[model samples]
Target: MLTPRWILLNRRKLGPITAVAGIVVLVIFLGSAFFSGPSQSQLDKQKSFTTALDNTFASRSFRFEVESKLLGENGFYSKVEGERVMPDKVHIKGTVLKTPVEFTQVNENTYMKDPFSGKWLTLKDIKLSQSELFITELNPLANFNFKDIPEIEMVGEEDLDEDKCYVYELKPNVVNAFLEEQFSDFYYKVWVDQKDVNIRQAIIKANRPESGNSGLDMKIRIWDYDRDLQIDAPVKASTTTQENVPY
Candidate 1:
């Protein structure tokens, strides 16, 4: 009788123990299933966004319109309007009237067509390079493979004027070393439209300690984007230079 009682008690304990163990296993399995991987839709969305940007940059010919304001060293502000047609090649013409002149990138070169002489003037290639223009004009979206730019973090959603947009911030990663050195301590803030993932605005800032200048800030606002034509022709772009030198 005593042996039978002991056996019955052990069986009773085993029943609850097995039940708790099973519950624990189920919880672990569910957690892993839910959180272990991204859903198919999430993966597809990322792929779609990347592909759209890629297509936008790969277009052969497009029209570009831009308005820019420059801050001069002598405490003067100048405004300019520019248009470019990249048909078989790139051609840009802008005039500040009396202040300064600006040009656009063509292939790996920078040239300005003189309004007076009706001749194209070749300028020394400086900041704007072919790769830089490609990334800047069409795809401000972070490319994980080409440039080790950090995975863009969608900070929040907001309405840029009337278009709904997602604001993303990009930081320097391993692939950004070249840019980091050239630009020197820079940050890019991009506004991408929610509807199409099209970039509507980009603000690029850099700290120039070498030149004893405070820094340089460039703001590019794209009012309209042509998706079918694969163009992001900025309606307005402003660049401000605030140097530390005596004003």
Candidate 2:
């Protein structure tokens, strides 16, 4: 009788012990499932969301900062700050080969102020060199189109500044002819805000033709969307005609 009673008591304890062990196993499984990284399907959804945002972003005003570096014997690094308003107005201030250059565009006309001369010249009034013209065309935000990309994929999610963004790696079917002439095998990575669909940051990398496999990289950051920016032409007293400077 004593042996039977002991066995029954042990059986009663085993039930609760097994139940607790089962619950512990279930909690661990649930945690692992919840903490797993995003899947391919999730990445695809993010890519689609970003594509839609890029298509419509230029309709508003924004500010941008660009950091450029050329890797090779003739390597150089420069920083550019730009502001733009919708329709057609832009201002860019930056350095090229350590020389400061500032330019503004309102409608079809562009004005450039020389760093050394401290004088401003209008694009319409002057014969611009290829390099100067190229600088004027550097509108990274408006110049790009989602349709131009051949391949794009979500790399991961990252925090840009204080905003959470989805990072994407992109390869274009063709780059701008002028850019292609200077650099080969170019690629881009962009960070898009998860909440607002705004582009938070972008990076462009390419190999210089003259430097063999040496590369050039440019990091672009966009912010201050729809903020008020006061852009105006240079004062008439400081303006210089094109003929004053030799091209």
Candidate 3:
């Protein structure tokens, strides 16, 4: 019923339309490849950031601010600021129950400043490793290894302290051993500087039986990297040893 001429005409008519449809399909395939989900490269980026963070803190000093909000019947909160130097040295100052308190550790010696006496009390024979002072596994910036984490996901890009950062969501692989029982669950979103891979901020949500509300929320900010700190013993006149203080 159909002639050869008619067949040729139909094929010619379908050529452009078929080509357009093929192009549309190709575009979709490429789009999905580019934007579907976390690719291998994305995972590598997050790992790279974590590695860089570990390396950076190993040889550098930084300042940190910790803010905590207690949820429960008591509604308690606190903000603590501290600076740490590598090898050994940390200075932390905070207020508890409207009372100001501070402590400084240098090498094997630690000194606690009494709020009421206005004097520094020496706490002897204390050695704090970098891991303990920096909160290695508990903090986003200090944990160099993530072998425990089942997976980490890129949350997206955002701004922190006016700087652009790539945000990543992570959960700690916590194991119940000794004090670990107190730490129930941990969720963290870390913001790393897009330019230098430096950590700008970390939001940590934790569950602990120690809290009246059993919820612990903390935000840690790191800055002032590589800055020299002047940490010297308090004036002798203003300082007293625990044994020297009158009971």
The best candidate in terms of TM-score:
3
Per-candidate TM-score against the hidden true structure = 0.48, 0.70, 0.71
Q: Model 3: residues >4 Å from true position, as ranges? A: 4-37, 74-76, 127-147, 174-179, 209-213, 237-247
- In order of listing, the candidates' clash counts read 0, 0, 0
All candidates' lDDT scores? 0.49, 0.71, 0.66
Q: After best superposition, candidate 1 residue 201: deviation in angstroms?
A: 1.2
lDDT score of residue 209 within candidate 3: 65
Q: Show model 1 residue runs off by greater than 4 Å.
A: 1-49, 60-88, 91-146, 173-181, 209-213, 223-247
Candidate structures ordered by TM-score, highest first = 3, 2, 1
**Which residue window of length 10 is worst by lDDT in model 2?**
127-136
- Residues 37-133, candidate 2: write the lDDT tens digits: 5667876756665564654464478888878887887787788888877756778888877889787776655688878778877765432322333
Q: Write the per-residue lDDT of candidate 3 for residues 70-153, one digit (tens) a residue.
A: 566665576778877775777778864466867777776667677887777775554322334324322324433343766578
lDDT of 2 at 182: 73
Candidate 1 per-residue C-alpha lDDT over 59-143 given as tens digits, one digit per residue, 9 for 90 to 100: 4444443332222343222234333333323433333435345455544445444455545445433224244433233222222
What is the Cα-based lDDT of residue 2 in candidate 3? 75
In the order shown, what is each candidate's alpha-carbon RMSD? 9.7, 7.0, 5.5
